[model samples]
Target: MTELVGIVLVSHSPELAAGLRSLLGQIGSAAVPVAVAGGTDDSRIGTSYARIAAAVKDADRGAGVLVLPDLGSSVLTARAVLEDHPREGVVIADAPFVEGAVAAAVTAAAGADLTAVLTAATEARHVSKL
Candidate 1:
């Protein structure tokens, strides 16, 4: 069986990440393996490297992991986790958080490989909001 790519959403607010996850589920990608790493260990308004790392590990299901960060520090924290882990299939996508997560989740639910899922996510950047 083909392995489905997993997704990780990082945000400064746990509510944001969890809300995004719910939104993704409502959008029909609930089967996709999605993990959330929002806020610090203390549940404060800050990104936690450890939380991000754990989320990445949890989301990965052999295919790979796609990480979407909400803001600057969240992105930095995700990158730091990637740098420390240095896994081959893991990647931090430079795509809009909500759009990218939805795109990636849908693609992954279709059993796409890591590269294709990442492409779907990155492509979200060009989506017209008008």
Candidate 2:
């Protein structure tokens, strides 16, 4: 089978990222590559460029990588990593954390390419909670 598009979840809180990673497994696809870039190297409540950079590298499985950041520093760090160490086939989705991750994971498990997985993540912003 072809490699699935990998996913990286970035958050200021380690628990938040790990929790969502688990939720993606339950609500999305277990076969999908979901990696977490949460907290600092000291296990504090802040984003880390090093962790995000490593997660992006570790998550890529050749198909591509979709990064979903929670907010604030998480987004900044992800973008900084990209700007400093730009890599092809690695993109950060400007979508909701939980929703985008679930959408991306499920789409990748279905054998979608990087573009399609990205579309699923971006389109997930329109999902109504009502």
Model 2 — which ten-residue stretch has the worst lDDT?
A: 24-33
The parts of candidate 1 lying over 4 Å away from their true place are none
Which candidate tops lDDT? 2
Instruction: Give the local distance difference test score of model 1.
Output: 0.92
Worst 10 contiguous positions by lDDT, candidate 1: 76-85
Per-candidate TM vs. native?
A: 0.96, 0.96
Summarize candidate 2's per-residue lDDT along 1-130 as a digit string, tens digits.
8999999999999999999989988875888888999899998999999999999988898999999999998998899999999999999999998888888999999999999999999999999989
- How far off is model 2, as Cα RMSD? 0.9
For each candidate in the order shown, give its overall lDDT on alpha carbons. 0.92, 0.93
The list of candidate 2 runs beyond 4 A from truth reads: none
Model 1 lDDT tens row, 85-124: 8998999999999999989999998989999999999999
